[model samples]
Target: MAGRRRTKHRKLVDKIKEDQRVSSVPDEQNSAAADLPTELLERILSPLDLRNNIRAAAVCKSWQAVATSVRKSNRHPWLMICPKVGNSYDFYDPGQRETYSLDLPELKDSRICHAKDGWLLLSKARTRRIFFFSPYTLELIKLPKLQSVHEAIVFTAAPTSDNCIVFTVNHVNPMAVAVSTCRPGDDAWTTIIFENQLPFVSGICTKIVFSKGRFYCLSEPGWLGVYNTNNGIWAVLSVPPPKCTEYLPPDYWWKGKYMAEFNGDIFVVYTCGAVNPFVYKLDETKQVWVEMRSLGGMTFFANFLSSHVRVDLKGKMRDNVYFSKVLYYGKRCVTYSVDRDRYYPRKQLYDWGEEDPFQSVWIEPPEDA
Candidate 1:
């Protein structure tokens, strides 16, 4: 009786295993998804946001191609924020209204600078090493060493381009400033010294902007300089003295001057303490800085570090100045409309917590990505 019972139990166990194997056959056959057409797959992936689209690319070869094709038409600039806790950064996608975190061990303790073409210039805090990195692809390209780059730095084009040029300026003598230029693959940087026709007693450059195939800079005490990259020529533009009707001193104009370019024109913004900003646009044909009655369809984003950005929103954000520092001093951020001349606090932009104090800069999302 015991032998008969053992035989019966063995047969029951074998039947259960065979049924389980048969049930998994349909699951394996359905997993490949070979029947789905590429066009339909892209259409399905089109509605998803950028982060989800990245995940869909990892599904299979066919899905990867479809996801890549779909993402090309849906790209937007994301706000990057680095937190204090870990080796990662969070990007806020305003279009999707979502924040995605990217794990970038390479950006650990890095100071960011000069963002262009979806690439950010990073300098390691401890080493002061300068490099360019793409947050989307985690690609890093190292550049040669630069020292004493106090205020202004800019690039001619995207770092990956063959004709890309990087330029930076620093104070050499009391009245002179030195400009340094280099390409991505170059062995060393070439330095150019500009000491002639110094406009101010201390010609320290606060910011640099590359516009109309040339580099324009604003120095301390409201002096504007333009550098012709093609001919290696530098000239200082004669700016009229600050128009002050009050009892305030002349030193008030020296503090808050920044330069930016928009729609083939250059603009200069000066903010002294908490007064309404005074904006001037360079009239190239006249060789003068003309005070703009209105910004028309452009907005100027200026920072205390002398970095400024110009954006053309058609008529959406026109006639406004968005500054990283608040009026009346402090580091609070706000935007002021030149037309309405009203101040709007921009605390909502600081949704992502920062490791250091909050400062915002505008960067263009890379088109190639």
Candidate 2:
């Protein structure tokens, strides 16, 4: 009986210890989340969208650090509105329908020429100074003063990178264009006059995109010009202009066009008042423009200064073209669906030509910002 009693007591003590360990597991798991390894945290948060990634950062300081370090390559673009009277700029996020304002005295009297990789290439007319600015980090990089204002300006990459190249082109004459190239650390821009073999008129309304070491300039009349950065050869592509004139209104046709490049494919969007915008992709192999009925799960953000393309967008955002215009008292952004063949929240009757080209722009935001 004494031996049996001792055995029962041992079993009871073991059961009690087992119960205690099970109860502590929940607390341990909660603590482990806060102390997770940086690599593991990055892996977990890297795939999340910008909104969720920002929300997760508020969980703890460790999470905020990890979120800041993750480079979200496919994040959505935000619309930045430059105020005419003050230094306060408003940024609109389409996904969240939220407007964020930031006081940027650095952008006072400055005009944004182009935006890519969260950096803005701005030109101040008063000072004739050209520089790069990051709205999120408030970082600024200065460039040499430009002798003449080249309205068509674009950069190859972020200003911080060694591969970053700033390019601009303007009409010197009907047959020639002044092409200027500069790097971030350069003392001055290198200007060259390239004579066009064909009729390619470049002006302040021209749009440009850089892809695969080449600069593709789309003239105001839809002519395509190609410049090979590697060999310094400039040629006009034989591809004909997209047939959008018939569908566009006669008054504001020139101001309604936007261009973007994604995965080496060039896309052009043509907008019409109260109508679905037409999308066309350039077939370089065939040297022709192909009208696209679908974006293949890609979303395009269109702006006068710069445009961007993103994939894997969620909900009603996929396969849509979002314009820089905000309507309904700044509560809703104008968006159009190519598949549905209609605009969200009804059609917009606003004329694109009347809008100020520099008043609003699409800017890529950093992951942490």
Candidate 3:
């Protein structure tokens, strides 16, 4: 009996020793991983998606430093769904098809005029006050109240930058426009009344884009107005509008127009009911609009207020045009492939004429968001 008892005690002791040895291996491995070089750590975390990169930063201070350094690399823009009746805003990541909700009371009674460089330019109707808001950091930078309502508003760069300029144009008369300009620290806006040499009418339907120190404003009638910020020269370009408008109905023509700038090139997109959208790029040398069959591996996100472009996106996202409309049931956004010349997730019959430009917007989220 004593011998059997001794044998049982020896076996139990051996089992406990083996269990301890197995557990210690992980700790040893973790210590080695934690001691990895900063460059190696960056390499490990660099390829992760935005969400995963953020989560990895929470592991330790060393990881946080490495992650922050690499977070500003290429990233897709997120769709911001503003609330119609509440303070909760939903942000959708199209890459992951995930939605995140944020309670932002500051956005109440405010209209988003433009989105760029991870900042939103908003205006309050009652106060007629325009401001820049960073959703990620909840930072608000206020600007002077406008004397009159702006038909359209845009900014050259992020509001935090010193070179940032806010520009707006409104119709003072049928042949003249009231141009307003201001910087971040300015107490008041400088207003200039320019009489158009041509019958260029500015209104709420106007689309504006800034490139190469110039602001190109597209009127509802498809006229191009160029404003040079550096030289203070404003003129109506003589170039005729794209010929694609001939195929669109007159009633839907103004609603389907969207303008964007990519790497100093201006692009115009037109959409109609159940029809493939038309794309045109400006030929600066020829001073004419050229129809494009392919976007050359670039993806465009079109919204009523503002539009954005990305190059060399992966998978179906490449050579496609994404609209602000999202299919709620399937949690998928409506994208038109420039290559296939059809809408994704099957053919979609969308009357972009019925879409309210202010319902939702495509916003580039900050790296730290």
Candidate 4:
């Protein structure tokens, strides 16, 4: 009887241990999630925004593996500002109407020259040391020192790319402009000077944009200066502004000029204080500027600080040109209808009569951030 009892007790103990082990196993749903294939998981997480995607990544190891695989792209442009009251900068999303703050000690002392693809080209006071930084990821890349590039700078692509090219332009004189180019891995900058025979004023603002694998420098007097990145040749292009039957007004040449690429074509925009903005497209084959009556589905955002960028018509922001009204004690955000020739002033970005000193810039946050 005692032997039989011992055998029964051992069997019960073994059965209890087995049941406990089985109970500790994960549930069906969790097991399925953990065993979910990476391909399907990526598809599920692909539509999440940067913030939600981060939360999804923290769910579990399998979710993280899949979240990291989702490609980052299709980012909208955000407006960035560094106010005088704080060390952190504010990023405003136009679509969401939300603002995000990022702590960047590097930007406190440095000045921003250019912003694109979520990367900022920052220069320290007078030392000529430049750094490319991503505010989202806090990644930093030191660029070659450029002492003469205080006017305009442009990058062909993201600084993380191996074949990226950076171009800088400095107006040297009334008739001459100095340009510099450098690759990401280069320690020094290559300088090129383009001088025109005709004399003009020197202090006029300049703008640069990268399109069709070349750098287009739009300078004062409405000239398209072309620098072929592949061939390393510089060409000065003179495309006369719209024919003025009457004597051109004083603001004719003094108007604000900017360049933007839309639908693979480059355009020059002329904005004056009280006149309707003008648009001209480059007829590459004929080497002339063709007046554009309508922008179709494109919109333009121009401010006092950065280059003009092309924004596709979406929702309420359609077929309009947006600019900041910073004159006459005004700080209004105004949009112009290219088709209707009307100005619609939206809410002001700053308080009325308060002079905001920071240079406003639009930046496309990196997808991979």
- Give stretches of model 3 more than 4 Å off: 1-73, 328-330
User: How far is 145's C-alpha from truth in model 3 (Å)?
Assistant: 0.4
**lDDT by residue (tens digit), candidate 3, 59-151:** 667788898788743567899988888999989887777888889998899999999998999999999999999888899999999988887
Clashing pairs in 1: none
Q: Write the per-residue lDDT of candidate 2 for residues 192-224, one digit (tens) a residue.
A: 899988888997788899999999999987899
Report the C-alpha lDDT of model 4 over 1-369, residue by residue, as the tens digit: 999999999999999999988886655556778788787887899987645776888777888878767735334566777667657887766555566778788676787777776788877876878888888888899987886745566687779987688787676777786768887779889897877664433332656777887887766556667788888776776655444212335645644565676556787666654456776788878877887778775667664345455543346665776653323323334567778866665332322112232356777755653
State the C-alpha lDDT per candidate: 0.64, 0.86, 0.86, 0.67
- Segments of candidate 2 deviating more than 4 angstroms: 1-73, 249-251
Model 1, span 80-196: residue lDDT tens: 665667876665543344556679888777777677667777676566578888887788999887755534566766789986888777776655777788889878788878874
- Candidate 4 residue 234 Cα shift, in angstroms, is 0.8
- Segments in model 1 whose C-alpha atoms lie over 4 Å from true places: 1-79, 82-85, 90-100, 147-150, 200-205, 241-256, 304-315, 325-333, 345-358, 366-369
lDDT for 327 in candidate 4 is 32
Error of model 4, residue 155, in angstroms: 1.5
Better of 1 and 4 by lDDT: 4
* Model 4 regions lying over 4 Å from their true place: 1-75, 173-175, 195-204, 242-252, 308-313, 324-333, 346-358, 366-369
Poorest stretch of ten by lDDT in candidate 4: 348-357
